[model samples]
Target: MMIGPTNLSLTLEQLTGTDAGSVDEAPTNMVRDLIGAWKTPLDQLTGREIGLLISQQDGYPYVLDLVWPMLEDDPLLEAEFYPGDILSSLMRADDTTWRDRPNYKRRLKALYERALRRPDDETEALRESLEP
Candidate 1:
């Protein structure tokens, strides 16, 4: 079957064993486990898949922490993933205002800035100096 955002969300819910509607109420350990389970190989994902994953309101923190780092390693994938599109999707995902989510704008801005940073082929030792 073709995978879309809802399909991806359902997969995540199944893998993590946390209902999407109740993700916020899930325990810290469960959330941590979900983070680990959500860490799919960046190379295996399509741009649209990546977009859908990050667009998920319930999955935002996991996507930010786990997925953004992977994007840094691949110039093509990083360039193809648009922060604006994700931001728009996030806004539309819920009726709540952006200001209500304390870290949403900060995290989004950070991701946008990271996207603008130069993509490099470097060792872990040299990676720190390359970050914006």
Candidate 2:
């Protein structure tokens, strides 16, 4: 079922044998690569777990959290896999399932807040648009 962000992080760490310090210490590109490589986990997981993973991975307060944003944003980045499509794919099943999770929404709000705090030229516009 749908794991909360806390549970999802715990589970993924358990499954992958990765720790917070290690995940944090790894080079940004390496983390991006790991996220990029885990596309299979995103698809194979249940909807809830998938949502959890998405929330946990992209919901962080650091730019490091945004990484590639989705598998399609990797070398395979293509117009065919529009941003929404890539986000949908990461959430598994659909955006409906992702939005239904209160935990995901909470994390998303936190992420939005984080994003607003240290925006660059590119994200400044996104931040303004995202804020109320």
Candidate 3:
């Protein structure tokens, strides 16, 4: 599917290598280009783009990793979702989607734990949301 207002044809499957059996350069480059495009002051990604990036399909883990570093950057200020809301949503994506890639799945979990421990503006509400 198309991402936000961009003319690029980024689909959920391409967001992660998913069934590619090995890492190819195109998807990574596509993601990189998307991020690069979004980072421009006039071209920030919308909440829907973020949602699509961290979507429940193949987009979750791999795209999550790619975008994780952007969370603390200026891009966060331009997005529609709160930092807490985005982090919590990323943490809650269906973990089972990548059951075959145990290590990758673990990495996503680690990101959540790291977020919780980092004491950022996001994790406080995320921690409260996950409370039992």
Candidate 4:
């Protein structure tokens, strides 16, 4: 499932369907590929699809770079009905996942601060998790 750098963009873009209904439950291997790919058209994906992606993640830099921003803008992503607990997945990040990335905590703290700017309960919850 680990696609080469050359195919990464085209795969993610193609996987990020232009039109959407329910999230695609088949072709789930794309989720594994996304774990290493630097960019994904997350904007075109649903809360459910993104949740699947996040669920499979290991707290890589992509969490800070790609996932959190999408959650910030989309109120729907905060809903509890997605395939996984996005908030918990984010909170569960440990040193093993980001040990070499010393900046992760600082960036996460900043994200928490930004989350406070939003009035929604989920974002507030997200803000709380980002710190711990």
Scored against the true structure, residue 18 in model 4 reaches a CA lDDT of 35
Candidates in order, TM-scores: namely 0.33, 0.28, 0.43, 0.42
Question: Candidate 2 residues 2-111, lDDT tens each?
Answer: 53233323233354455434434557854643454343333244433333444444433211132234321231222232222223333333345344254454444444
Distance from true position, residue 90, model 3, in Å?
Answer: 3.2
Expressed as tens digits, the lDDT of each residue in 19-85 for candidate 3 is: 3332334367646544443332222445556654554243434444445556544222223445455
In order, candidate lDDTs are: 0.43, 0.37, 0.47, 0.46
Question: What clash count goes with each model?
Answer: 0, 1, 0, 0
Q: Which ten residues in a row have the lowest lDDT in candidate 2?
A: 75-84
Best by TM-score: 3
Q: What is the lDDT of residue 113 in candidate 4?
A: 52
Q: For residues 7-122, what per-residue lDDT tens digits would candidate 1 score against the true structure?
A: 33334545445644443554775454344435544344455555656554545443444444444454223323433454334434544323344454446545445544644442
Which candidate's lDDT is highest? 3
Relative to the true structure, candidate 1 reaches a TM of 0.33
Local lDDT at 100 for model 3: 44
In the order shown, the candidates' Cα RMSDs to the true structure are: 13.8, 13.0, 11.3, 8.5
lDDT per residue (tens digit) for residues 1-132 in model 4:
222222222324354433222234435656444433323443444555556555665324434444554545542245244311565565566655455445544465554455455566545455445464
Question: How many backbone overlaps does candidate 1 show?
Answer: 0
Better-scoring candidate (lDDT), 3 or 4: 3
CA shift of 68, model 3, Å: 4.5
